[model samples]
Structures are given as C-alpha cells and as structure tokens.
Target: MSGLSVLSGGFIAGLFAAVTAAWVAVGRTVGRRPRPTTAAVFLMAILLTIAAAADVVNAYFSYLPRLGDVVGAATEGGSDPHLKTADLRLSTTSATLRAHPRGAVLALPVPDRGSGFGATTALVYLPPQYFDRPQWKFPVLYLIHGSPGIPADWLRGGQAADAGARVAATGHPVIIVMPRMSHGWLDDPECVDGVGERVETHLLRDVIPTAESTLRVDSGWTNRGIAGMSAGGYCALNLGLRNRSVFGSIIDMSGLTRPTHAGGLGPLFGAGPQAQAAMIANSPDLYIGGLGPGPRPRIWLDVGRHDRTVAVAIYHMRDFLDANGYPVQLHVRSGVHTFTVWRPALREALSWFADDVARVSAA
Candidate 1:
C-alpha cells in the first residue's frame, strides 16, 4: 500500500478499536449482573460492524474511483465534460469509432522486416490541431501493449487514442504509436536480435522505421519516448534501457523488472537457464545500474499498493534502482493491479514524456 493508504487503514482500525473499547467499558460498568458470554458476543458484534464499515468506505473511495478513472480519464480527458451530446463516428471498414472531442485517427502499417510476422498494424492519434495545421510533425510517444493481447489492447483497455488526443491538446502535440510485438506474452524477449525470435529487431528495424517514414515524426532518439502496461511495460523498459540509442525516456506501468523465478520464464522462452540468464542480463535494472551517470533516458516506475501480484516485484525494482544510483521517478498509489490504477499511472507517465519530448523538440 502507499503511505497514505496505509495510514488511512491504520487510522480507521485504531478508531474502530478505540470506539469498541469504550463501548465495552461502558457496558461492563452499567451491567450489575453481566454474563461473560453476552459481553463477548457484544464486543465481537461491534468489531465486525466496524470492520464492515471500514471495508465499505475503502471500496468506495479507493477501488471504485480507480476503475471509474480508467474509463473517465480516457473518455473525458480531452473533451468538454459539460457536453452531454456527441456524435459517434464509424470507420470505413465497419470498425466502431468512439466519439472523441479532441483528436483524429491515423492507421499506420508495420512493415515486414523478415521476422516472419508480416505487416503489423499500428494506430496513431493526432491532436485536433493536426487537422487545422498540416505542416507540423510532433515528437512521437510509442506505446506498447501487454501480452496475451495485441495493439488493440491499449485502445480497448486504456482508450489510449482518446487519451493521447487529450494530452496532445495541452500543447504536447504528440503522435502516439501503438505497436504489436511478435511474442504474445507480457515478458520481455530480452530485445535480443536472434533469441527464440528477433522481436527487438522487428520493433526497432521494422516498426519504428515504418512509423518514422510514414508519420510526420521527429527522427532522433531524443525525440522518442516509450511506455507500456503489463507486458508492454516489460518491453518498454527492456528496449529503452538496452537500446538507449533509440528511446530517450521509458515508463513501466506494473511491469516485471526481473524475470519470473517460478520456472515459468524458461518454458515461456522454450530455453533453460542460459536463456533465462540472457533475459536477466537484458533487464532494465541491470543495464541501468551499470550506466556511468552520463546521458541516460529518464525512467518512471509505478505500481498499485494492493496489487499483490506485481507489487513486490515493482518494489524490488525501485529499490534496486535507488541502490544503484540510477535516476528514477517512482509512484505507488492506492489500488490494485486492475486498469483502474494503470490508466492514471499512464496519464501521469504521458505527462512526463510530453515534457521530455517538448524539451528535446525545442532544442
């Protein structure tokens, strides 16, 4: 849990305990022939009631809002909140285009760079201004999607196109590229050139080159920023850290810093200890830790407090970075592993990337 959430929980528990103690004390004083069993039952009932009340409050304020924010931020960030009526547009190919108040869509093709996965698809979001002013090419923010999923996950899960438009409206004017990785899981392919499958080669050589060529994008590494959720987050960190020549900044939203130690990774990569060693060597923490305090990308790591699954891993990453003297911005918020937490984290991450992008573009 975050410091605030932990404090809030402790405060509520203490308050309940104090009230219960007072009530028990009062009841004991008033009852001249109090039965021990009756007193015990009354105390238990009071405790249960207090616990239930705390749980309800926690769920409402913390959990519910987190979920709603994922949807609300994506839908509401770049639009007029006061407008109740808006037209929903439809795509030419019968894909439902949800209404957005501040952005336009661009479908870009991912080239076949000999990875055998031919011509992947990527969706780019251009701010509303791009339509009015055609000569401007914005710095690109390449967003990667998670595993057991495709590029569509960011659109469907985070509604990222709408979010990017909203963010772009605030003067960032970024082109958000959602690219599909060849491997279909949330773990990194180590970004190694020819290991199992050259996923990194496909990304850097094919996807990025195609994006830069087709889109009005800034070409230098300093103008590029990468971020992702879950598996996408893993890819972002892996690619950004190892290929520092390409990405200027990296953001990991609930991604694993180290490979899974539970033997799942070996089977996932279809290799044994040696392959796992290579993956670990390419991990962000190891590479970033070894850097000699020169020009490295800005790093942002965030996790939800109640996310029991990845919280520990995230904490280890944060600690490792700190101990290794790597510069990182860490945010631990109150929530679980759901999109509720990730969406807000993503918004904040984009804001950071936008700032970095602006600085680089202006230079």
Candidate 2:
C-alpha cells in the first residue's frame, strides 16, 4: 500500500469508499451513547473525513506519487544529507553507477560566499557520458526545483536523473545540477535578491562558480541553461533572461510571469515605493519588453491546457517572443499544473537544449 500510486483513479475511489464506510460505521456504533463519547467519536470521524478529502486533492494534483513518500519525508527528516557523493575527480566513477548504465546524483554543499542567503546542499546528476568521455567538458543545465519541495524532489518527483540519462543516451549528454532555491522546504523567496535573501546573487556568484570549479562542465555562457517548474519555472525565465551572459537557454514549465508569495510580497520586497519598483523589475514579461540589443537566449515555454492563468501567461510570452524575433518554442499539453506535465517537459527541453548545444559546438 505504501508503494501505491496516489494518482490512480481506482486508488482514489477506493480510499473515498473506505473512508465513507468507516465514518458511517463509527457513527452507527457511537449512536445513542453518552453525549461526551458520541461527540468525541463524531469529532474524530470528521477529522478523518477531512484527511481523506485532503488526500483526494493530493491525488488530483499528484504532488507525491506514492504513500511511501509521506513516510520517507518523515523518516528522512525532509533532506538527503546521507546521499552518496561522487568522487571529486571527474574521471572516476562509483561502483553504483559503474554496474548500471544510469547517471548518478551527487550531493554538493554550495557555500554562501557572496550572497547572504543561506545555502543548502545541491544535487548534481552526472551522465554516463561524463565518465565515458573523461576528456570532454559537457554543457551544464541548472534545474531549479519548485517551492514546498527540496532538491531531492527533482530526483524523486521530477524524475530528473532518468530524464538526464535518457538525454545522455542520445549521445549529447550534459551535466545537470539541481540546486536549492531557499533555506528550507517551504521558503518562498521567489529566487530574487530582495530583503534578507539574495537568491539571484547566490545562484550567479556561488552556485554557478561552484559547479564550474568542482565539475567537468563548460563555464561558457552558451553552454549553460536554466529550467524550473511552477515557481521555480518563473525563476528560470527571470534569471536566465536577466543574466544572458551566464545562461544561454531558458525553460519554464507552468511557471508564473513574476515573483509571488502566498503570504504577499511585503516580507520579501518591503512596503514602499521601492517595493513596487522591485516587484516590477522582477516581472519577466514586463522587463523583457524593454530588453536591449545583446545575446538572446533560446526560450522554451510549456504549460498545461487546463492551467488557465499560467497557460495564458505562457501563450502571451510565446507570442511576444515570436513577434520580437527571439528564438522561442512553445509546447502546450493536456493536463493541469502538476508533475504529469513537468516530467516530460523537462525531458523534451533538455533534449532541445542538447541539440542546440550540439549545433553550436559543430558550428
């Protein structure tokens, strides 16, 4: 039952049936009992019913695939501190990946050198080609995970390692790095350099340099790409476009057009005229309109058909980029804002990026 998929319709139906039956049985058993006892039983049943309803919402969204994910999240303390790390020497390979033909994920402790934002451990997916072609320096793709998630969510939920391996099998492998966006699991900094967290500065000054220095990936601007889903998707577009000299490709999967927080922007941007200006500056769609003449990064926009507001934003961005003579690709699929759309989107975007990098390298 722990391994059962939460997204399965049959499973969801069965869950609802079981919960309803249990609630009904509890009510009947406690009927005509003492007032306090009956009331307690009713309260417990209501709480259980609410939990079942929450599970239905989770099933619809496919936040976590398996019931074990909840247990794992609790048991593992919401972090992968003990995940195996690859040898710093890029030429070597661990016995784990040596036996299998898959890429390996390494935990990297990126330091907060310049940006005051707290840094968490980053995950790097080294393709099979990295060990095979020891002399070759591969392009790097920075994958930003969604909020309410950790770096390991990219591996478990996004299936990023498998996606990177699939792209590697195509003979155009790239180094993929999934970095932590904030200090904790629920921190929603929006990947911006405002308030106490200088996330943008951290990515540019700390994460990028850390990867380049420690990994066997090319540090060239054209060889680097950034991608993310949900809020992280917005970060990829905003960060990649703003730092064209560092990143040459951008992929946004069901992302918003600007920085947002469920608790409002006051904590991150403050309350003043400067706050309004800061918010405007971070809005990708707003600033991209005034983009000056310079190196233009390839843009990939993908959103679900049922994503309504996000879909509209993505379509508008596609049209704007197309009309402005920028290289942009749009992919709209049938789904909502969930991993069902993002996993495939990441795979396709990475393939596209690999092809673009190959063409550039060949040229």
Candidate 3:
C-alpha cells in the first residue's frame, strides 16, 4: 500500500471516465458491425460495474468520512493536555485560541508580514496522539491550498482530515497545519519571494515561527514537512527547496515547474522586470540541477496521467529530480488534477511522512 500503487484510486477513477466516454463514442458510430459493437458494449458494462464499485469504496472509506468516529472524538468537548495556548497578539481573540482536545480543529492567527492582506488564519488539526503525552512534541506537516481556495478546502474539499485519521491509525504522533496562502480575494500568492505577495517569506518568517511558538510542534527540520496541490504545490516545492533546513520532506501534486500564466503575468506577480526576475528565480527547475548533498530532503512528486494541464511541468520536475541524483518518488496515476488524484496523494504522503518521523524519533 505504501508503494507507487497508492495511486490505484486515481487510476480507477480515470479508467471509469475513459470507459464512460468510450461507451458514448461506440454508441455514436452509425454503421458498425453488430458483433463488435456488442462486444464493446459488454466490455464497457463490466468496466463500468468495476468502476462503480471502486467509486463507492473511495467515497465511503476514502473520501466522505476520513476520520469517522475518530475525528468526532478529537473535536468533541474535552481537555487536551498537550495543547499549547496560542499566543494571540490581537486583543479579544484569545478566547477562540485556547487549548484543544486531541483531534480538535484550531484556528490560529498568523499576521500577514508581507502581503498586507489583513489578518491571516491558519487551520490546524491535532492528532489523537497529540493529547496522549503532555510533553511530547509532535511532528508537523504544513498543508497549503491553491489559489481561489481557502484553508478549509483541505478540511472539506479534500480528504485531509481523513488522511490524518489514516496517519493516526499507524499510532504515530503528527500535527497538520493548513495556512491561508492566498494574498487577496483575486490574488495568486505565487508562493515565492517576490514583489507583491512574498508568501514564501511569510511562510518561513511568520507561519513557521507562529506554529513553533503557538503549537507543540517539533522545531527540527527533520520533523517538519510541506505539501500542496496546484499553485500551492508549486509553493511547496519552492519553499521546501530553499528552506531545506526547515522541512525534511515535501509532496508536490500537479505542481508547476515554473511560474507562468496562460494570460499576461503582470497581474499575478508584477508588471516590472524585477518581478519577472523573481519569477525566474522562483522557478524550481533553475535550482534543482544545482542542488548538492548538504541538505537533502525526501521529495515526492505526483500527477495524473490524464492531467494534461500540469502533466508536462510535473514531468519536467520529475526529470530534474532523476537527472540530479536526488532520491525522489515520482508517480503518475490514472486521474486528472482533481480531488481524485490529490486526496490519495496526500494520504500516501502523510503516511510516509509519519513513518519517516517515527523512524527518526525512535533513533
């Protein structure tokens, strides 16, 4: 289950979609042989049945209720001894930033240090084991959401909580932090150290420090991990690469190799040469080839076979990782760049990260 086969759900979903489309295509042929057509129909019928079963399994166990009773137990009314009181700087907000029970969802205040986009809120999930030992410092995973997305997207839109539940089942201690990555209502933070948003610095400067100070997160770089999808994925790569001293591993799903746009880039980054320069500097492709052995972190990159939009860039990233002698795990599942691909990717990453942390913590 920990192998590349972790992508079976995505592959099955893609196969289902393709078979459903093939069913339509075959039905549309006007003058086809009846025998061949019948065979095609029979094949599609069997495939569809199998696809339906997979979908049901994914929805109930993988998607809908990832945590089930475990999530409820964590969020319910109880005292978590390991919970660290958030150092709320703003007045009248400390009430909402109190100690949480194991598996509780907490809203933490992260001040915007660069983007000037008002006060930021990061949603964090405390695993069941977090409250079991009062003095234990849990490993942390920083999850990022894409543009046009909120912190809650990981909580609701994806199976992050379910993934956490799955991680907890391994009997490891971990913490999940979902920080607000968007700079504005219509902004793409680019997740780079740039002219406008500077979300990268925000993460290294504000987010990490805040989490370390407010939560019972282990500060060692080996105990920290980062991952994101789409734009957030790109950010994860950038931050994890440059801040290798902080993150021990990273998971990039459908991430862009470079910063580009179908439209003009003036709006997203800036309209000046400096912004263009920053974009080029932020391109992970530029740095991948030059990476040395000093600070190597476990890297995982995944994309869907049918995900035409980001597939090319993701492959480029995989190529760099392979060519540069960096030990990486790259997977191409049978899916598009949607939840079908991202959810499982996150789950596998979390599981692997937990195992990695356990091995390190044990040592």
Candidate 4:
C-alpha cells in the first residue's frame, strides 16, 4: 500500500474509535435506564450512518476521477493566472531560455525536416538559477505531454516551468524540455524510426542533439531523464527504455503499458503484421523483458489507485519488470486519471530526478 492509502486508513480507524468512545460515554450517562428512548437510539443510528457515508465519500474522492468541475476558475483561460508575468523574464545567465516566465506559451522554431507536419516545436523551461550560475551546465528533464495537448500542455496544465523554477530555487538547477509528438498521442507513430512520419527519429535524432548543442546542458546520459503524463508517459517509457544510452532515467506518471486493441493504432501507423510487430516492440513492458538484467535506466512507475482504465496495465508492467529482474521504483498513490493527480505526481517525479540526476552527473 502507498503512504497516502495508509494514512487514509489510519484516519478512518481513528474516527471509528472516537465514535465508539462517544457512544460508550453516552450509554454510561444514561445510567442503564430500562431500554433507551426510541428517539435517542434513532438519532445515534442516523449519526453513525452519516459518518459511514462520509468515510465512503472521502475514500472515493481520494481514489476516483475528479468530477465536480471540468474547468476551475483558476484555469479559466486554459492558462494558470497565478503564474506571474515577471517570472517569464529571461535571465542573462542562460541563452537557451524560451517562453515568458509568467505564461506557459512558448514559440520555438521547429526542425526544418523529419519533424512531421513540416512543423516541429519544442517547449523549453529554464530554472531560476539558470541565469545565476553561468558556468554550470544543468541536467535536462524532457517531458512529453499527453494526447489532445501540445508541447505547451506541460506548462499550461502541469505548470512545469513554474515547478522547474521552484526546484531551481532550491539549488537543484535543471532544464525541462517538452516536445510536441506527432498526432499528440503515444500510439500515433508508436515512437518507431519509420512507421508513419519518423517521430522517433525526430525526437531521438533531432530534438536531443539540438537541445544539447543550443543549450548549456550536460551532454552525458547521466544528466538526462525523460518522463510524461498519460500518452506522454507511454512515450517516455518507450523512448527512454530503448535509448537508455541517451536517457539515464525515466518517470512514467499514469501511462498505459500497452496500446489498446481499439484499431485506432492500426490505421494511424499504416497496416500489416510487420507494422503491428514494430509497434509492440516499442512497448517498454514487451521489450524490456528481453533486455535481460544489466544496468537498465533508473525507472519510476506510478498510477492513481482509482484510475480503473490504466491502473491494471501499469500493474502488469510492474510485475513484468520485477519478474524479469529489472530494477524499478513503484508507487501506487491516491488519485485518478485527471490533472489533480498528475499535478502532484509530476512534482514528486521532478524531485526524484533532481536527486538522482545530480548524483549521476557528479559521478
């Protein structure tokens, strides 16, 4: 069980104990009178029922998908208003700084070719200390956003840049890169070299090299980590596992282990068993098993307990990794398939990378 679950359980148990003690006190105060008044008994039963219902609701909220409001007032314009405009100011400490610190919108030139759609853009986040330490080459964490979202999703919804700035303020300087994947979905091209548009090539060949060359970043794999949310999570695991030489670690936050059989994947990539086989090969759980031991990248896999859709798949992937003797850090927490869960998950993942990447880079 995860820490959140354990804490919730303890809270519920304590509530029950408190209620029991109250009941005993009331019974003793009644002085064992012959048969308690019907009204008093009825009131006690109602209160107990209410308490039970509250506990159930609390548990459900803790694990199930958030359903109250689709868009909160805070995200009114699909952007976080809390992010200050001054935060967007670029510091002279780094030349790679992109996007206004206050807003999530960023406009970077896409690679000329092989980027699919003739337009390839990257979302860049520079830490607050990036300008303070001109001599330091900070590590990089490349985050891929999920479907129906562009490169700016991490900045807009996940508030990645702000989070990066906060971590940087703590003295753990790093850069966060969010790239726009073809079609905005993981199974779109299956992250293969030449499936439909060469997205894998664009990312591994073009994006990484361009970032290293243009930015003041550490070029070694030890200083690099990849991660994502939802479909992006799937991409992170697939790409990170395959290119372990480039990415030293991976953080998968609420990602599905396998593509759905809904036939969308087939039509999107092309046709035939060869294509299907290629797609399956890119799945981390499917291929990681074959790699067989040795120094695999540091992996962190997590999912919300209430996320019924992908939680089972994540569980299977975790089991597969453990059975294959692969090292993994697994976390099952209280949340569902929504930004509420992803926000916290992303924060924790970043902290994990901050600690691990620093050690690897120092070594």
Instruction: Indicate which candidate wins on lDDT.
Output: 2
Could you arrange the candidates by TM-score from highest to lowest? 2, 3, 4, 1
lDDT for predicted candidate 2 compared with the true structure: 0.77
**Tens digit of lDDT per residue, candidate 2, span 256-355?**
8888787899988998999998998889788877887888899999999998999999998888877766799899998888887888898899999999
Model 1 bad stretches (over 4 Å): 1-101, 183-195, 260-263, 267-276, 291-294, 323-325
How does residue 30 of candidate 1 score in lDDT?
86
**Which RMSD values do the candidates have, in order?**
10.5, 6.3, 10.6, 11.8
Model 3 segments beyond 4 Å from truth?
Answer: 1-102, 113-118, 261-263, 268-273
Q: Which candidate model has the greater lDDT, 2 or 3?
A: 2
Clashing pairs in 3: 66-162
Indicate the worst ten consecutive residues by lDDT in candidate 3.
61-70
Residue-wise lDDT of candidate 1 within 19-137, one digit each (tens)?
Answer: 66767686779876447787667767776666566545534323222223334443322233421222222231212333345765556667687766567767676565555556676
lDDT agreement with native, every candidate: 0.65, 0.77, 0.70, 0.65
Model 4 residue 103 CA deviation (Å) reads: 11
lDDT, residue 18, model 4: 67
lDDT for model 3 = 0.70
lDDT of 3 by residue, 1-363 (tens): 011111355656777676767666666774563477686776778776765665455443232222232244332111334333333345312234443443556667887655454568787777766655567788899998876455655765465766776788678757888887765423565676555555777787788788888777887878999999877788788888877778899889888877654355665567678767766667889877765776788899988899887888888887887787766888888887667788788888889889998898889
Q: Tell me, by TM-score, which candidate is best.
A: 2
TM-score of 4: 0.69
